[model samples]
Target: MNTPDVAGATGYIDTNFKGKAEKAIQELNDGCDFVYIHFEAPDECGHRRETQNKIRSIELIDELVLPVVIEGLEKFVDYKIMILPDHPTPIKTATHASDAVPYVIYHKNAEIVSGIDSIDEESAKSTNNYVNFGPDIMKKFLGA
Candidate 1:
């Protein structure tokens, strides 16, 4: 519900990413049980075939966003974080691909045994864990 106009050179980092992270942290501090933060820069860069920008966007998410969010989540005793893309947008094709996207579920209190250290398509597929239907992932993520 807090969509900002991210339509310029620095829009990816300033508005779409850092701003979204700040808003999510605010919502968490406000006692919201669930907060969904989405960054559109990587997808947008892929669509535009800006390969370097796409890499930079992902880097910004890791450097500028995730650390802040993790710090915010540390204030709580228990929390879960799910990170994933809705679909693949290949820079070469500049279009959406049907390939299954990668996802990672991190439970603060659980001791996960999965050896997957990276959250990328290859690592996800290597685990052979997949939700055949995309919508079903929500139910699984929520433990419903």
Candidate 2:
């Protein structure tokens, strides 16, 4: 998958994803329990002022990046993958919206969570580990 030229950034999403994936694989091999991979393409496309590009970026991530991450994840005995956008960036406004976007938590052990989509705002908010949105969210995500 190819990413359109993203101005004011050092590299595009696909390139950065490749580099980040390698590091994440190494870290996972070293026995880290959790790993977070953020796909910046959709957000970048929003800033670039194109709805098609943003849509394509999300498709590309699912087609190209996700499979790669899933392969690496299989190396772990048991793992959970949480996929969520930090915030919504409307292509029209080209700015982030303070809204709750749906989050997905995929488990290698499917029995832990429902197979079908059962996760939602209320469930996530009431879960044992409820993380309020903010700068600190990254800290919670990284387990630092």
Candidate 3:
């Protein structure tokens, strides 16, 4: 197995989603078959119980990062994207929860008719497709 190279910003609020997205795009342009981009602001906000900031952080990711990455992915003939949080950090408890988190696996050329209008905790649960083990999700994402 090939060891993945991990690179990103390190500070709490300084974890720049846009920069990370750009790096991911660059990796793709440089012939990388897979790139993982992680945004930590929302998790940090959840841990600090900053509910509004958490929401805003998620919004920033949607606005400043995902679109850029999606556009970058368009340059490729085939690509798969898997978006998910490692775990849930509820603002009420200001700590990590063992509850399952939502995930989205999108294939570029496949026609999916799942009828799921959105990707979120509730929506993922509504699909009734749960992977009990974490690594299993990676296998599923890679079509292994």
Q: What lDDT does model 3 reach?
A: 0.84
Off by over 4 Å in 2: 1-14, 110-144
How many clashing residue pairs are found in candidate 2? 0
Full ranking by lDDT: 3, 1, 2
Clash pairs (backbone) in predicted model 3: none
Residue lDDT tens for model 1, 92-116:
9999998998998888888487998
Clashes of each: 0, 0, 0
Task: Compute each candidate's TM-score over C-alphas.
Answer: 0.88, 0.65, 0.90
Report residue 5 deviation for candidate 1 (angstroms).
Answer: 9.9
- Each model's lDDT comes to 0.81, 0.64, 0.84
Q: lDDT of candidate 1?
A: 0.81
By descending TM-score, how would the candidates be arranged?
A: 3, 1, 2
lDDT string for model 3 (10-115, tens) is 5355566777888888888987778877678889999999999899888888898899999999998888999999899999999999899998888988847788
Error of 2 at 78 (Å): 0.4
Full-model lDDT, candidate 2: 0.64
Give a tens-digit lDDT track for model 2, residues 17-106. Answer: 555665566677876655556667778778777798788877766776677788888877877676777777888889887866656655
Cα deviation at 68, candidate 2, in Å, is 1.1
